[model samples]
Target: MPREAAPSDPQDLAILVIDEDEIRASIIEEGLREAGHQRVAVLADMRNLLARIEALAPDVIVIDLANPNRDLVEHLSHVSRAVSRPVAMFVDQSDAGVMEAAISAGVSAYVVDGLRKDRVKAILDMAVARFQAYSHLREELESTRRALEDRKLIDRAKAILMKLRGLGEEEAYHLMRRTAMRENRRMGEIARSIVSTANLITGDEE
Candidate 1:
């Protein structure tokens, strides 16, 4: 996290790291800390990446590009347009050369509206560093989320099964897990399906 020179509200300023390289990520995180940014979150695995970004309401977003992901570009485009935040990219229209330099360094930065160029450039060095860090964090977080979500879905599915089948918790969970595996789907997917079906059965949709 980068510490603020003057204390800013947590809602006022935040930075998110979205890189996948551990070593490079650390360097960026530490650099931001040294640069006086304290409100930072490293996103390792971003399951609902865009939603998380929206919830955090960060002042800036730094993404690490190992290769481009459609989800990322789409999210960025949506954020840049729909949300009040500023989404920076290395397009030929806006400072193409600087964007080129940044891409060469393996990072890109986006800030919210009303940030002056001079102020942004003042933090450019740190922004570049944080972009790499955030990317690494995003990958790690995503992995953790997958593991955690899997367990949660299993538990929820088990509860649903027990309620519906008058079976023990263990047996119910096992049934759902086996079904998920056989179907080549995630436990959450199965759980969601069960919920939807139940909703329909109970006439909750209307």
Candidate 2:
């Protein structure tokens, strides 16, 4: 699955606290307020979770689950994947397998027995930082993949020009470069157009 990048504001970070227990939710809310976070929302149950999250559009999501079942954890993981927000999950206890699975599903920060009023701010900060880092890495990876694909396209286009026009490799490359410069387009774009045209003419789908 692809990761989404969301905007954040340190001064006024909108936070959503998900906890069934009213007392725990208040504690978390109090801590956030004490830390100067004014925009905060608390969800008591998992009903209409996605719709509420979409409506609120919080910058950070702090979920405090007491003895969460497998289905609940999986559902939260799915929500984390669907939403482009930083998720900090606090559980009373964590299992090794479940933790690994949740992390793989894109939960930003998972805490075991780490739900304290004083630590809420710090954990939220850490979750946002981790989410940003992961999004950056994903962008870099996608860029690299696109670059490699473009390189291959250029190579294929050059080979096609050389074969059809009986031109040398340097001549083919220079011709493509000249056309690219004239059209004010990128070399990769020019190369892709050339390859597409060749494929169309020759009926070579590959």
Candidate 3:
């Protein structure tokens, strides 16, 4: 999902922290306040995380895992998947490697969609930077799955042009662009239609 624009006031930013340790929570709250965020709340019980999140609609959330709570994972998954909300857990279900390590290491965060990367970077840096050397490396993998799917669609569209009109690759690409402009449709939509027509032809051939 696309991220929306940031709100006008950064000082009005709200944050929530869920941690069993009161001292740690206070430190995080102070750090956030010093960074110019005004509204900060901390919950010691994991059980209240979801309710607070829904009611307050905070800009960022930090969860410290003194005691393991699988419920937090379940809640993040729901928010990310169902409502198209941005939640930060290392195990982004959409990103498999991140998701796996996120699950194992037990740090979870959620950000409202379109929070500036600088803000997130600040929070993560404060939280993760001082960790002991032994716990430092998380799954350093990124997936190109979305890019791969886009390329496959584009290739399928090119094949359709080749088979139907005997056009070369460059010609086919130009034809797709021309059609997209004429119809006022996105290039991806045109590519998808081409792929669908190609599938029909292949089915007939088989």
Off by over 4 Å in 1: 1-12, 67-86, 90-96, 127-206
Please provide, for model 2 over 1-206, each residue's C-alpha lDDT reduced to its tens digit, 9 standing for 90 to 100: 12234324443656677767565566667767877777778888777676676677665566542425324543544555665443345432433553453354343333222234334437555433444455576789999998999899889999999999999999999999999999999888999998999989989896
Reference-based lDDT, residue 20, model 3:
77
Q: If ranked by lDDT, best first, what sequence of candidates would result?
A: 1, 3, 2
Query: Which regions of candidate 2 deviate over 4 angstroms?
Result: 1-118
lDDT of 3 by residue, 12-99 (tens): 6677777776666776677778878777878776666665566666677777555565356446646456544556543234546543
Taking all chains together, the TM-score of candidate 1 against the true structure is 0.48
* True-vs-predicted CA distance for residue 99, candidate 3, Å: 11
Provide the overall lDDT of each model, using Cα atoms, as 2-decimal numbers. Answer: 0.65, 0.63, 0.64
Against the true structure, candidate 1 has what lDDT?
0.65
Q: Count the clashes in each prediction.
A: 26, 0, 2
lDDT agreement of model 2 with the native: 0.63
Clashing pairs in 3: 90-98, 91-99
Q: By the TM-score metric, which is better: model 1 or model 2? A: 1
Q: Give lDDT tens digits, candidate 1, residues 1-206.
A: 33334334333357777766556656666777776777777776657777777677666666676635434734664645666554654243456666765677677767665545644553555656556466667789998998787677667667767888999987887887799899999877887788668768878771
